[model samples]
Target: MNATVLKFGGSSFRHTEDYHRVAGHIADRLATGEGKIVAVVSAMSGITDNLKEVMLNVNKKASPSNVDAALATGEMISACCLEAAISRLRIPVMSLNGYSLGIRTNSDFGRASIESVDPKQIMAALLEHDVIVAAGAQAIDQSGRLTFLGRNSSDLTAIVIASMLGEHACEIYSDVPGVYTADPYLVPGAQLIPELAYQTILQMSLHGAKVLHHRGVHYAEKHRVSIICKSLTSDGAITGTIVSGHGNARSVTVARDSPVFSCASLEECDSLCALLARHDINVLRLEDSHGVRVCIVSDIDFAQRLVSLADIGPVFIGLSNVVTELDSSGLLVHLVGDYDGAISLVRQIHEQMYPAVVSVPFGASV
Candidate 1:
């Protein structure tokens, strides 16, 4: 079964005309006799924020699970609305929630990872409908409990879906034209980059580039899936950024650039590492300063769970863009990322805040 997954960001449905345009584009793709299409979409623009606001207002002491349940409604609404719009155009389409489509996640309420995906249900659904509109970022656990990914993780939803579909490439449609040499908002005259290596794109995301998140890129790279990042409002030719994956290197020994979580003590660090080790999680010490403990890990789920542990103090999360320090209360105490005239967190790909473009050739050197 030949199929492709198309993901639309929240910006694509910000306005009324945008919904029509996106639906029309999907219709156009189907008109040409392409195979089945699965379109993944985020919540409508401003809807997620509005929903979050509602959650904050309804109950300040709400649990993370409750908050996730509330926030997920935004994507659900977007998917249903888009499905309606497409169906009105005389196209066969149906909206399906992640849980109904056989997406299962871990118990993490607000930031869950896909544990398993049964694509049989999705394939059968697609066979009945020309397009399957999936509500991204929210899935169910094994016990039939609702869980969510993270903020702005619709990209994760898309890539995971593509991986399950066994597709080579999935298209991510957003408002940004494409990946640029530098952040256009930060550096004036920055131009587009047509292609990028998967490793480079992962670095860009880990470093603070908002165009794509590292989790999605990491999953795609692991599954040998390519991602095409393009604009939702483009016309004529399809000029976008292509992130290509590479096979396992038999001879190339690459440095480990995973982000680390630092604590204030040794006993705490050792115990934390020991506990994580049982789960097949490895922690690598990267730096030492004044008896400080710094260990690198793959993801932040460990840090999130360590919030209540009294052993660690002031857990610092190092991201590509910012270093977030979580207080003992698990709240964001302070954020430090890219600073002007100063060196930010260093990564294997880019050492400075102003990222050096080594992934693709200069498409537009303005």
Candidate 2:
């Protein structure tokens, strides 16, 4: 059962035509003697956010289970669309969603953790079809209810699928060619990294690099799976960086605006922090002139819900990014006033870190 696992991020499918483009790529791979192909796809660009917005706008108090069900539709639609495109090419293809994917998770709806994976279904599907499109970042709980993995979590789904299916490596395609010293889109001086250690990328993700999900990297390390990051272009697929057991480098990461909750006292802050931690939410504690504050860096919506459930009134701070320099020494975090400032700091940090390489521009040649 030799199969090639590939994941196409939301950026890959910005419109309906993009699906056809990707389908063509898959067909070409199959035609080129690539055996079984398993493609994990995310929702079309901004589709997930659009769906989430509509769901929450109508029912602000929607249960986690219900929200998961609504949010998973984006990827489901993507899977089906891709399947249709592949079918149009007269290729034997099929699409599977959370229900049929055979990956089971706990009842932690918003950020469900995988409990087990039964690859028989996927294997059987692959045996019948040339390409199998699996909806990313979704699974079913013990009760068979739909559960979303998390925001920007399609990477995790792809890695898990590759590992469970006995595949040693998985290729992830996104807007960028590969991991860079900083986000290439924002930092023009950012240079593409050819390779990286699992631990290094994991730390980058943990501190706020968007190249890969931290949880996914953790799972890949445990399963000894190598992640090949690439970008799909009109010319074809271009390999960028490979994440495995070796390589080292310094990078800068800028996190999105995190929800900050002001706690009255230190005890209250610690208690709230522990509760969030138990739920697997990441938080950072801070002491300021006002009092104690807990910054929710993981999933802001889920964190807000938990805070409300705990009967705590969260003080909403304006959007801000926490920029950090990642290296062997330690993390040097800087609190940026805004996203612009964060990008500026990232450029400064990246320039200072790799001054000689700042002139290089990333492209297919890399």
Candidate 3:
């Protein structure tokens, strides 16, 4: 009836030593009188990609079902490895795949949608095992074939389990300490968002913030399950970022690493927008430069789609080799929360917290 879920991404288990370190974290948590904790783990880093390559080499014409099975081996392997590592720490731990934990999905193979989870079985397992290590991403269909839940589904996996048990929050441990205003690498002065609204993070995630999956955040928002994003590669007691429904409503900016398609006219823009929308690809932003219009190609799928639309190359600023001429100079600024009033003009922008922090060197700590 009560539990805490810990979700670890592939980056956390990059090596055998990493597994040992993760186990140490788990063991320490259990020691702190945390009754029952469930760990939803992803495949080790590079393991999933390597497994997909194996499938490609062995069978060029492999079925979607086979690909699903191959892709799942990474998480399955991770769960087992963690189980072993934790057991060595003198803790009782058990590894369970999505199916074993009652995670059911639709028959979508590489892009499965979780339909339901058997809470009875999950509860029974928690009663018997000190730690339940559930494999993330991959689940079984109605016909019982292993299927993956798209990219970053491990976070979804943990959220689902936590929601099933009515837990308020799930702790997602990753390499990054917490979500930031922008990619720290790009904006070196970017500040860590101490707390954020779920909707804010969801938009950030959708607009190419690699902190967590949008679907995962959607599930959390719908189920009222908050998420805490922290770093596994950090020192003691890092609280990280708490993503919930309550936060200051302000325009949050996030940048993405992608290109844009500049349309010459409003007619060209309308057609291009409609086409990409039909394919379910989101255009991050649109800029009107005098008589010309530009559509930022933030979504990777949209970029791929441009390759076959060479016939309409001229429509997009007379560029036939559209994909070849990727404009990496542009970055996306995703806005979160709501704001009223129409903008008179669009000029310059600023990173998260401002260019206004005056420190009084001679004053007392304030």
Candidate 4:
């Protein structure tokens, strides 16, 4: 009835050998008497996109249900790989996919919202195994069809597991150890935020920070589950930031690759926005002399599906990047037409808010 919940993102599995490495880490944790653990896993890097490309190439008009079935396989394969690695380490381990995860959602396919979670199966399995690897970002619908929660949503899966099992905290491992004032890779001056409030992090995610999924943050906040952001390294696990009820920081978020569409009329844009919101998609509306432009920063494919479903004749205006700065005053959004400009603006804003640390050694002064 008691277990620790952890999640490993795609970046953790860049190569096949990384699976064994993660399994070794899990074994090491067990050696430290961490007790039974539930490790949620995402698809190997680029595999989901590859799968989607192959599926779409074969059938451009495939139903969303079928697409979900195809995309869900990536996580299932990862679960199997990690399970095998753990078993090779002479550990009692099992893996579960959407079919048996006991988490149910509506038939929303690409961005399904979790409706109910029955932890009996997971608990029963834990009684027989020390580790249970649950495929993340996937659940089943009422009709028992596979459903993908959303892109980069494995975080939600991990948090949901922790909440259902009555755990107060969960660990999420990614390429970056924790959240930063700006993307560390792009902005050399970016500083790692040691702690952040639930709402603060949630806004960052909503603006396309990529550190965590917004839905997952919302769920964690609602369930009062603290999120421990960490990264596994050669030395060991490094805890970067903890997200709970308190803490605040000024940060800049840049969503470099977002799709934008031009609606013929304001009414059409409004209708499309409402439709997308119902499916839990975040949209930014911009009005100009030409028409209404709607930008979708996350779940682009699902947003396209919704647009198609609505039969709105919105012209594709191509991708527009978003750079946002959040501080004590408020959030300021900047829409850039090019990636270079977005990156430049991010550095400029990051430098202004985190000025004193810009000259210090990267990743050291913070």
Clashing pairs in 2: none
Comparing 1 and 3 on lDDT, the stronger one: 3
The superposed Cα distance between candidate 1 and the true structure at residue 144, in angstroms, equals 1.0
Instruction: Estimate the TM-score for candidate 1.
Output: 0.75
lDDT for position 165 in model 2: 90
Descending-lDDT candidate ranking: 4, 2, 3, 1
Error in Å for residue 317 of model 3: 13
Top candidate on TM-score is 4
Candidate maximizing lDDT = 4
- lDDT against the true structure, per candidate, is 0.68, 0.88, 0.70, 0.91
- Sequence-dependent TM-score of model 2: 0.95
Query: Root-mean-square deviation of each candidate, in angstroms?
Result: 7.4, 1.9, 7.9, 1.6
Q: Indicate whether candidate 2 or candidate 4 has the larger TM-score.
A: 4
Worst 10 residues of 3 by lDDT: 338-347
Q: Which 10-residue window in model 2 sums to the lowest lDDT? A: 357-366
- Residues 41-82, candidate 4: write the lDDT tens digits: 999999999999999999998989999999999999999999
Instruction: Please state the error at residue 99 of candidate 4 in Å.
Output: 1.1
